[model samples]
Target: IDVGLQTKSNIGKQEAADRAVVNLETRYQIMNMVKDFVRNPANKNQMIPFDADSTSASASIKAYNELVAERIKLGSSAKDNNQALQALDTQIAAMHNNVVSGVENAMRAMRIQINQVNQMSANAGSAMSAIPTEEREARALYRQQGIQNTLYTFLLQKREENALVLAATTPKGKIVDHAYAQSHPIKPKPMMVLFLALVMGLLLPLLLLSVKKLLTTKFSTQDELAEIIQAPVIGEICHNRHKSQLVVKPGKTSSIVELFRLVRNNLQFLLTNDGDKVLLVTSSVSGEGKSFVSANLAASFALLDKKVALVGMDIRSPRLAEMLELQSLPGVTAYLAKPGMNLSDIVQSSAEVSGLDVFVAGAVPPNPSELLLSSRVNDFIDQLRAHYDMIVIDSAPIAMVSDTFSLAKFSDAVLFVTRANYTKRNLMNYLNTVMSRGQLKNVSVVVNDTNPNVSTGYGYGYGEE
Candidate 1:
């Protein structure tokens, strides 16, 4: 019934120790004892010494009352100055004779020796009273113990029952276990735990791979990507059919390229603000198709006869340059460090994706954080905005790196990508906070890697064919 059948009332060792540190309260140890007793297998069904035989209850009560009445009457008569005291004496003599005979008969019947009931009652009462005092002393000792001591006691006596219900010393129901309850917990299933651990080890990367599929999220249907982003997607970019229709092999045709072209056309509609056309194609975390979306998006914009600059702002672990096979020569870091360097040297063209230009991050820098926030980088983006009709910047993994925030400032709006299964529920809140607290304008969620299976299709087409 508790977290692992933990009574939750156990005086934890720390709490016990804390008592020792200041006020001495055996409260902690006492709690441990009770918990141990309750959980003990040997005493599991033990009726805690409070159980009474209910079958003979009515007869017992009747007999007890009658006996008490007879005793009081005899005693009062014996003490009385009245002549009836003599008759009481006679009655007592008769009763004593009957008891002696009755006691001898029952001794044989029960195989037990008879003790004087009055004397036994007097002796037992003293012993029982002494027990309470002894108990009180033990509690006092516990109170002297420190919190750590209390915790130690609790830990040592886990699942071992101690006397807890002294006040609740009434007959309660017989509570039992289902025979298979591990007194020595078969729990934390070692194999299951190992299996779960292996699963956990693989979960993140698998999710990362899954999210890397669809880059820019513009649902073909209404709210197709709802599972990823709570924010209303700013706009839907229909599957563009531009140079995407252009045959990759002189005459070969494809619809996949057309799909990206549609995404690019929709992005065009979003860039109405004109001056700061720096588009941040970023996913919630890494592997959410942000790089692919950014690269293809820039290509799509360039195809419209618009001068487009695809800047790899992802200072930390830039993958866009690798994907396009562009020279990872001096790009953002190099050009930004030396503002006087020719932007043309860095502005290398993508060999395959036509009309799209890419600026590689060059070598991995020790200080990517400082590079994005550098004044030179800001001026470079400003300068690029003037030259290119649309400035599509591919930045670092949003969650992993702090670089995106600095680069994001240069952009007018941002498109956030989230992997359908990879993105956790909490990440949506994290993304929302990034935009809300940062006050970054035009932030939209693009759910990526939408699987055709498993997704609940909660408007996000999470698992659509």
Candidate 2:
């Protein structure tokens, strides 16, 4: 609104300035015409020059009076009307008439010039008067434009304010009443909460159990293994309760130990009559108890009065010495490192089983892969092959390292070990790769750490007694 008023005022000022310019132009034109008339050569003599001190009519009258005075003097002096006096009188009258005519002509010319100047001034005035009309029209136009601009600006400002108000003001719903808590407690309904929690407790596990059953890819039964690999599952070893690696004892009987005995019995059918059977026991990954299974299986075979050498081929992380509780040095790595070291010196006897000989991973070598791939390992296996009836090489996991693939060449059979809940279904891809590549001979899976209650088919009816 203020801007509108200011705009109207500015427009009015602009109109006034225009009217002033027009008036000034009109005055300028009048002055120019007056100057032209005054300077015109044709009207130069016609323009009368007036003097306050000297009047033309007065001067002429004074000359006529002087002539009459002279004539009177001459007449008084002469006896009769002489020719000189008449002539003088005639000359005086003619001169007076000429002076009057000249004065009249000069007055007439000045009047005409004055009239021309007046006409020019009138034209200038007329033109100047027209400026007022134009000024009114221009002012009206300016006022209209200003009004439009002001209205537009005002509307825009109002709209912006409305928008700001709309943006700033959040619409709150009508409140019926303010909320206040009751004197008594509303929550802590133990029975209701316990009911819902009980329902959730029951439903949640069932839902998760269904999902796990549907999504499980790991072998839960020996049938699943047989279907996938088309190989005989020599044994399903139950999870050991004891922390010791050698779960099998001489006269001790347990479900886990009996499972190893069952594995030893199943392994007899897979072996060839080729003197010493080299069995490479490995798994897809570590902690699946390949070393444990190898140690126990070697012990199981030893219990049957068969000579068995459990060689720790996992040179990267040698755990057999820890498992067997024997000296790890002067084992495989030591025998390989020193050229003159005897195999008998590095071979240690396990007190757990009489016929079971344990060769631990001597020391961790930087080049374990290269050491496993060397011909010396094959020669060492051959030396052990001549002595031991069964050579159980506890090699590194096939999925983890390439050391197992190299050791698989010296083995007549590969016992691929996998845990029940620990191994995932994706690990089958590694086994499939090993089988497809023929990296291991006669590869068969021994699903270790089997829960007998979960999978009753492979439980062999052994229980904790």
Candidate 3:
């Protein structure tokens, strides 16, 4: 309502200014008409607006018409003086047409302006009507013509008052305005926009990382897997183990064979056909499936028709060579103590798997770590490698004794058996320190007793991604 009222007031001022313009135009036209009327010698001294009353012309025309009607009613012979009658009729017609036409035209023009005034009044809208304006030169001319001086004096005063008012109401020529006051700005509040964008840019990456951590159940990196195992992760096989096979055969599968193939692949890559051919297999504590991996890794290579010998290298506790009911023989400890002992004398063949061989850790060594670390043990490994295409050497765990580290340097690769939620972190830290010092160049870590439901656990499925 306030805005409406303000707009109305401004419009009122504008209308008054417009009306003043029209009044000035009309006054000019009126002066022109008066001048034209007086320029004729006959009308120069004789004509006065007060003398030439338009209302009087109209009344005379009406009265003459009434008399003409009465005369016609009195006689058809009223035209006895034809010349005078004709002259009277002609003068009446001219007076009547000119007076009525002039007054009607003026009134019609006035009505156009009156319609606008009426509309503005109905709305109580902003507008005003200014008094008719006169030219200064015209007013001076009127004074020179000896007309009443009071009228000109009054018009002059009114003109001067209005000029002062208009000057006051209009803005100063140099009034300050916003540079874009005439149009809208395109880069409004640009600094604020940039600040907001910068904030979001920093936050989005953190938001995505948080969301990823929340949704995934499986471990993605070696570090995470190591954390779960509570053991040092000696190494990693980047690709999935299950997808690859030792050799392709249709519609047949061996879970044991496949796992061993992975172990063998890692072994061959790390071990590089070097020391530790006569290996041992044992866990920190039992039920870790150390026997399973040792047994299968031997057969996985044997399936290629290669002579792969699986030796029960764990001397303190021995079960690998006995699982299949093989005859007991003086194996690793015997070979370690007597460098003269031959590899063929101790090895036995597996009836269950062809091309595969087994050997027991005949007698548990009193000092397995010291026995395995002997110079004679190094000779034993070199002797076995000459006869077999592959040799899977399973060793005693570092968690049980430091013996594994002694054997680690001699072996082509060290495959650490880690049970989920079994091995402690501090023990593994010691083992890791040993490996990092290049004690075992080809070392790999495998997770056992792993929960398959965990995305990063064993039995993880994969293709090319």
lDDT of 2 by residue, 13-118 (tens): 5555444444333333333333343345563222112211125543654465456556655665664569888787687757556444544544554555555555
How would you encode candidate 3's per-residue C-alpha lDDT over 100-197 as one tens digit per residue? 45544554554566566545543533222222235334533643343334335545665675455444434334537755454656665788889988
Of the candidates numbered 2 and 3, which has the greater TM-score value? 2
State which candidate has the highest TM-score: 2
Candidate 2 regions with alpha-carbon error over 4 angstroms = 1-214, 457-465
TM-score of each: 0.46, 0.53, 0.43
Q: Report the C-alpha lDDT of model 1 over 271-343, residue by residue, as the tens digit.
A: 6764757888776677666776777667767766677788887777777667776678877788877767978
Best by lDDT: 2
Cα lDDT of all candidates, in order?
Answer: 0.56, 0.71, 0.55
lDDT of 1 at 246: 20
Per-residue error (Å), model 3, residue 444 = 1.0
Of candidate 3, the 10-residue stretch with the lowest lDDT total is: 44-53
